[model samples]
Target: MRLQVKKWNLSNHSDYEKQCGQYCYKIVKTLLNFLKFLKNENDNFNSIIEGKDRQIAELQAKLTSLYSNEHKPNEFDSLRKLITESNTAVINELRSQFLDFHNNGEIKPPYDSLKRCQNESTEYNTKVNESKGGETYIESPYPNSCVPFGNSSKQYKINVAGAGSFHVLCDAHTAGPGWITILRRADGKVDFDRDWNAYRNGFGSLNGDFFIGLEKLHYITKSQPYELYVHLKQLNGQTIHARYGEFAISNEKEKYNLIKLDLYSGTAGDYLKTSKHTGFSTKNKVNIQYAKKFNGGWWFNDYTKSNLNGKYVADNNLVGMFWGDLKILNLVKMLIRPKV
Candidate 1:
């Protein structure tokens, strides 16, 4: 009986050993898998860190190059400086060079030369050298008015003929697109009651209220025949527009005279037609009797017809942005497009 009992105990002990071995093998396999996962995660983390380090090194190199004494300014930088300086002699000299290039057939034309230069300048200023994946290129400046953008309502940089490069808000969705907003008054953040210089050179933000400037207006209008569209919004959200088939203004020497306002048609009355042949007037440069009294800039007539640049008020006062007897406007926009 004692021998049989011993045999039974020995068999049970052997089975217990086999079970322990199997359990230990499973624990080892699980540990190996866990270690492999940790290794993979570490490799991935290292790769990401290396990529970030490369980006950082590239950025540091660019920064060093930008601030280096050996860095040279490109043609675009030179032109931007000249335009910003506003030196008449330098500008004339540049124009003369462009004309010479035109005459020599090296460039297409004077306008094209300026436009090319401005486009290159814009590209140069916008280009950022970085990693292949990080590199980005902005679209070149529009060669002419709003025509280049083509039915896309957004602010685009336009190189005006003989007027240099600047941004303009193109009204594409409203009234069949391709209209350049020269003046807009909304929120009254900009002070339109400015001086002759301010009015001539322009002021305010394109995103808010802004005037595209008289000199720019003269160049743009004189370049091609344009139809003017004056948009007005009432306090009640009603809107009206006055479109003129012919609209233009003279140069600064002529005091930016409103030369033409023919073929007017719109919901608004033809009050501006009376101001035809009149020059523009600000508070300081009052060409008309009511120029100072109106306290804003416009081609004012002998009487108070319309003052879109007048004080922004919430009432139906004559002093606000009113067209003839129209009530004080909530918003006003003056845009133009090349005659179709």
Candidate 2:
């Protein structure tokens, strides 16, 4: 019985030892889990703190840049002022060099040769390159939209007498607001660089367009068939393609003093007088006027050769002088005598 008691006590002691080892293992595993959790929290806090520090550094750099004078608003103001000053200087230069007929009336000589052609009509001294069938070959100098004359599959021959005054008429009503002019150049050879006189208006001035004087074909005497070029230029000073074509200006019978040119097509009625952006009719006559050489290219509308302020000028714009917005359609030379 003693032996049995001792064996039972030994079994009890072994069971107690096994239970304590299990408890110790469980506690150690719990503590290790808690330590891992703390480490994760510490890593999270450290990452958050680093992100906030980066943000603060960015803000500090931005503040430093704002305070720097190199990026100040006044620095930009200086650039703006420089641009404004440059524009003003350019405008002042143009004002000094620019010359208009309304401003500079009758003047003598000693002016620049190019500007001289603006008023002097007899200053044309260059000959043009001859064209076959009097067709002018032209190239445009603008980078904008220009109303094109419909393509001509075959060129037609409209003979203008080298003698007497020749007239032209465009009867097409243009859709847009644009003015046209017939540039009368003496020489068929156009040198845009050297022959500035050939490009000058009568009285030898800086302005080449809007000129009506000796430089233009205002008055002419009988001569051989001259290759007179017919160029259509813009009057509004817009950078549009200028219409260009040439017709054989040969000598013809001086039966009538005036030759009224009409559009060969029925388009003659399309072109009429316009004022303040409104179109008006010209009862089969365009306001044909003469710009005298002495008057510095001022228009004369009086039908009377004596009166320069023309009265019956519009009675014929077909083959005469007037700003128009029409295509040079068919060439129909219809001669009309001026009423006394």
Candidate 3:
């Protein structure tokens, strides 16, 4: 038996072209208007361009299939070649823009965010990788290095849009005379006297002298022992809580003591915890309270007992983290924000 293939027909589509074109025309017009609207943005430039690239690629794909197959009109041959070439060119252009601006080819958006998030003051050395441009590869400047957390506490607002794993590095050996705080404000504006809630962490020797932790700012002082001072902006804020927090750590340590802060989904909710390789380990669950015995002590991982990794120390002079989930909105900037 002989089998024959049937040639497809665009004429059959004549019935739908007018209707489809009318609908698509409206969508295309809307998209163009939206693109223009996005042009006003200087902050999310990379994201905007990325979105444009995706739309271009998708539209090209659809058109290429139409022209190459069933709908191969007499006018389509040159157009098909142009669309295929445009796909390559457009993609190359997008990639080229990234390399020019970011010096990295594998970049994703929130464009300028692809660059280092540094304070205008060279003094605050939040050393970001000039090429990669993010908080992921931050480096503290010197021994006992300490800087104000999340920009200035009084002037700028550090906002977060999502929640994820993060870290804190410092002289855990010396602990430090430093602290970092993540606050939840009314309008991303932190009012020290009135802001609702926050998460704080630190390391150092002077901790007893100037540590303002989970406690509310009003109730906290450099020397206060009030742990419940957390000013709650909202409970669910953790779920979408834009990643914003205060941080302080001593650069005085001899080793980098990589403190991995893990916040992810768990049995109860989004839990924030930490881990270290040696010395003392961060408690599996955050210790929400400060008592006479475990006051400043980090939560000891129950499984590992007191030692970090496997090494044990008798010094009861450390503290750890907690666990839970929450939601936040419209986080503009923070060292530990959403998943890029």
Which predicted model would earn the best TM-score?
A: 1
Ranking under TM-score, best-scoring first? 1, 2, 3
Report the Cα lDDT for residue 86, model 1: 34
Candidate 3's TM-score reads 0.17
lDDT of 1 by residue, 308-338 (tens): 8888888654466778888578889999999
Model 1: residue 205 alpha-carbon error in angstroms: 0.4
Question: How does model 1 fare in lDDT?
Answer: 0.72
lDDT of 3 by residue, 1-340 (tens): 8798544445777846766675568898888886665464433456545664565556456554543454312123334344445444545554455555445423353334322221111211111122112233233232111133323222222211111122222111111223233222233222121111212332211212122232212112111211111222233343222121222221113111223333332222222233232222222223222211232232233322221111111222332112232122222111222121
Q: Which regions of candidate 1 are displaced past 4 Å? A: 1-141
TM per model?
A: 0.58, 0.18, 0.17
Candidate 1 displacement at residue 163 in angstroms: 0.7
Whose lDDT is greatest here?
A: 1
Error of 3 at 144 (Å): 22
Q: Model 1, residue 56: displacement in angstroms?
A: 56
